[model samples]
Target: AQTVTQSQPEMSVQEAETVTLSCTYDTSESNYYLFWYKQPPSRQMILVIRQEAYKQQNATENRFSVNFQKAAKSFSLKISDSQLGDTAMYFCAFIDFGNEKLTFGTGTRLTIIP
Candidate 1:
């Protein structure tokens, strides 16, 4: 069984600031994929970044980056230079190799304060 946890239910940060959304997961699988997804007011889920458990390198995309601690099963997302458009519900997700289903965290609602 696999489960993802997001400790912070809601958070707010000023525009242009940096914010980190915390996530922790547990899985028995030796190989898996960790991901951060963002859902805006439109309710469209967007992939922020992804990390392979076999890879030691953290994943990054533009202003979005992840701190992936494989051993600790911790995957946190850092959003730098936050923008109003960045306000959304962030989810932590996991999926083992060859698994078609994904387990998702409860999510953290992030707001960019003007």
Candidate 2:
């Protein structure tokens, strides 16, 4: 079984600043996908970034970027120029081919202070 860990239960950042959320996982599968998802107050899980275990390049999307450390089995999310809209619960998840469910971390609630 694969497991993800987010040690920080909550984080706070001022607007326009940057904050990085930590994530780590343990998996024996060689081929798999790691992902960061943001769930706002609306309860919708939105994809932030995805990193394939085989890929060396980190994934980035606008203000959201992931520092994917394949060797260390770590995937962290960095949010730049944080905004009020960025306030949400962030989750780290993993999934391998043929798997029907995504194993997820407990979550880290991020609060953006204006």
lDDT of 2 by residue, 1-114 (tens): 899999999999999999999999998888899999999999999998998888899889999899988889999999999999999999999998769789999999999999
Question: What is the C-alpha local distance difference test score of candidate 2?
Answer: 0.94
Worst 10 residues of 1 by lDDT: 64-73
Q: Give one clash count per candidate, in the order shown.
A: 0, 0
Instruction: Candidate 2: give the clashing pairs.
Output: none
- lDDT, candidate 1, 1-114, per-residue tens: 889999999999999999999999998899999999999999889998999999999999999999999889899999999999999999999999979898999999999999
Please report, in order, the local distance difference test score of every candidate based on alpha carbons: 0.95, 0.94
- Point to the candidate with the largest lDDT: 1
Best by TM-score: 1
**Cα lDDT for residue 12, candidate 1:** 100
TM-scores, all candidates, are: 0.98, 0.97
C-alpha lDDT of residue 16 in model 1: 99
Segments in model 1 whose C-alpha atoms lie over 4 Å from true places: none
